[model samples]
Target: MHTSKLIKDTPTDRIFLFVLYIFIGLAVLIVLYPLIYIISASVSSPLAVNSGKMWLWPVGFNLDGYKVILQYGDIWRGYMMTIFYTISGTMVSLFITIPCAYAISRRDFAGKKWFTNFMLITMFLSGGLIPTYLLVRNLGMLNTVWAIIIPNAVSVYNIIVTKSFFQSTIPWEMQEAAKVDGASDFQIFFRIVLPLSAPIIAVMALFYGVGQWNDYFNSLVYLQNKNLYPLQMVLRQILVLQDMQQGSATGSTISQSAAQAAFSKEQLVAVIKYGVMIVSSLPVIMVYPLLQRYFVKGVLIGSLKG
Candidate 1:
């Protein structure tokens, strides 16, 4: 007969584990409650949302918010614009970032130290908003899709992560052997390095794609045409109009008919705010799962390696 021994925690360890579990539970509640509330409020009747009657669950069920958003023409146009920006911008960023990081990762690349230090320094400091705006203006990129995609095309942190991945993961001997076999640098890089770098590439694409998808600040600042506005900008316009309506409803005296119209509009807007949250966030939430396997592996290998 085989004897078995079970390991058990002492009183002190059990108490510490209990406290940690309690803290973790509190943290989860803090993060989860807002998401629950937003979803509940989005589907609830406008009046219920406005009156705070909807809490953890929806009250006075209604689909008017979704109906309105779906019917809005500008919402669809902005949706297409956002998709264009995300795809084009991610392509541009990745193209610039990958080769630059690979170049800096190689020991034989001249002045690599100086270039790396320059990038690291830039990570700490930048020419602030005004100078950057002037630069973009001088480039004649304003009001164009270029403004959304060009100005912030490359991120230093991304370069660092990619450089780390290249340096730590790729064996220098492989390149040396390729060179000995009469393969050119470009040939070896394209044929071998890229094939092996799928995980990091996926990770980079996820990061850049998500960033571009959510970006509205660039559109708000650089774009003047309604047609050029992205989804977030279009949604922002709705939210702002709602705020203006609220101010007029409460602060300014109006006729009974006008007052009732404003009240109805305000209620609808309140529900729309929550509905928009779910809509805007849903894309990113859905995309993350597709790249999640590569995300953890890439980040860990790139970050943990010397």
Candidate 2:
């Protein structure tokens, strides 16, 4: 090993680096401020939140907002519904996307170019919402969980990313060796390709999971039944309508207590609103840490390949 002498940065270089760090610091603060404010508001006393006592940290810290939000039965039901939709939808999406991407990545596959063009065409062109809704209705999928999960299951964008990953990350030489050992196409894919494709799979799971979790528009359009409503829809109802149906359903004991709280009902509702937003988003937040290591690598490799 050779040791290299250190050269100090020139004054001009030092000045530029300092300026760059300052700019990056300001950008980070700009992004982090709102997130901190939301978390502070969610935990702060209703009066503290409404009076703007909350800043970077919570003032008059209390859990009343969370307590009130969690008291709702519908919130729990919505949680269950969203969990089911996220898991089931992600599994379905991965099943379709992974194989399709792998197949398209293989040079020997027939109609590869045509299939790629077809997927791209659908990506740019859609039948629009009206036709999509009509199609779902005609298929008798409307008002069911299938309407929410099935219509948008296979994302063309994901297919492209996964295909790029397979092409770049999985070596053709490995597949050839497997074939030489009398492995069929299916055996090679299952035994060899998939094992080497964990990074992309994790990335796809994160993408699909987050998309399905955050989705509410599909639920609103396709599912009229409140029982089938996902967390986002339920949160919307609570935030917008200030329904407090949960408290009322539990009887006047809870309702009277809520009314007797330190802050007025509307102010308290405002506090609960922030808590609901945080609660609704918590799952996706938790998921990010697990997939973050793979996300960048997967995206970079997948995008850079031919």
Candidate 3:
């Protein structure tokens, strides 16, 4: 694979590769710059951010933004709720998705094709938001944790990926061997197939966990109780409505209050905005690397063959 070992590229090929590298480098900058700016802005003084002093690095660095955010009792409650939802949701999704996928992958399973088609149809078509809401309400799931977890317990896309992975990675020979040993289908699945499916399981866990963590729409529709709000919803309230209100109140006071207090208020909001962005995204960023090794392998193996 080394360039020195490979045959020399033609002039046209060289030029194409050079252009491709430049394009890729530009794309990286486009994506990376915003992340760097957010981090820098979060740590910078509010005045520095408001005055456009921060670019690549924090200016007049301070932790006041984080200090203010941590002081909010609602944020802590939201954090706990999000953690509970993510853990519980991922467990439920995996238990349902994995076993169902394994079953559909089995060639001997009766009506597997019909089941797959039914799942696919549901993927493309759903009762609209109103009907779905009414069902949840009638089921008494509204304002409950199940409202967020049960309705989205299984993703058709995940099932497809996992089924494809099982088909490609686990062969019929293994199942035949297990059967020769007098193992039932459930025993083979639980003892043998599950052990070999670590990579796909990790990938599904990451996907489902991130979805649960980032979900606010479900909470918005089903949860009228502020106590049940997830971290994303709490951050949305802080970054959107609360920030606007704070800015307006500060602007009104600016005309009557001392110059220092007015300046501090403006800068504080600027810092808090960036800080909130970082806080909201930090958990996903931290969790991704733990499962990254399995992610590419799972997606490629699951998709390439099927």
Candidate 4:
């Protein structure tokens, strides 16, 4: 009887909960609406797309844009190159960051403080772009795939986050017990520490994977060979050229037929841009869900406790 009365008296709480859910629903819609519109516009005919006729659904369904973009062989090559870079770079980042973070997390290690300071300093300072470019040139990494992968192998922020997680979550008594059982430092770390640190590792993998997958600036700066270009650089080029082609060629002395042809080509290119985004980003986006399940737990567990 008391419980029933308490439940019945919670009208104010119910009202607040209803209002919170409504706000959350509205926020989700606001975030998802642009993505939905983009997907719809990509499939819609250029005439329907440009006239702002599209809403929640495609204005006129057409696959012409996708067909035109896929006809270009270089885009496929760029896709393959990007895949290689993202996978290889992520592996290198993990190799460098994991052990380094583990070492820093241990309080008793000699020179640990100095090492931590050195890493923190890097987070605050770097050789400017010109110096970095010169260094890459001197190393003969220019125009090669290595330029993109090697220079960014370890991110300082990621290292700090990883170290914090290890320190906060991993108990020292566990390490001592492993040592008592005749396990070497390497065995302790690999067999015990890493196996138990799945959440943080997943978080780091997602971070490194996303960074490598989306990287384009370094490729543009160092790589002169078009064959070595990542998907992002290729997409950027396509979008820029597409926009230029779209601008009015009316005042120019070009013939009427040429002007009309240019306009049509530009419209086609505009549609292709949206299609390219869908193609390039979809794979990376799909990977998020697998990693996302670990994100909240990883971040919460790994954060500094004191």
Q: Pick the candidate with the highest TM-score.
A: 2
Assess every candidate by TM-score: 0.91, 0.92, 0.89, 0.85
lDDT of each: 0.83, 0.85, 0.85, 0.80
Compared with the true structure, model 3 gives a TM-score of 0.89
What tens digits encode model 4's per-residue C-alpha lDDT throughout 187-277?
9999989998887887888788888889999998999898998888887877776323454332121123224444355455556678888
lDDT order of candidates, top first: 2, 3, 1, 4
For residues 1-306, could you state the per-residue lDDT of candidate 1 as single tens digits? 999999899999999999999999999999999999999998887888888778889998877777667766777899999999999999999999999988998878999989989989998899998998999999999899999999889999889899988988899889889999999989988998899888788889888988999999999889999899999998887667642456543113222322444447657778878888888888888878877887787668666543
Which segments of model 2 are wrong by more than 4 Å?
Answer: 1-4, 242-255
Provide backbone clash counts, one per model.
0, 0, 0, 0
User: What TM-score does model 1 achieve against the real structure?
Assistant: 0.91
lDDT of model 1 at position 278: 87
lDDT of 1: 0.83
Candidate 3 lDDT score at position 259: 45
Between candidates 2 and 3, the lDDT winner? 2
For candidate 2, lDDT tens digit of each residue in 28-93?
Answer: 999999888889899888888888777779988878778877777888999999999999999999
Q: How far is candidate 1 from the true structure (C-alpha RMSD, Å)?
A: 3.9
Q: Which residue pairs in candidate 4 collide?
A: none
In angstroms, the error of model 4 at 215 is 1.2
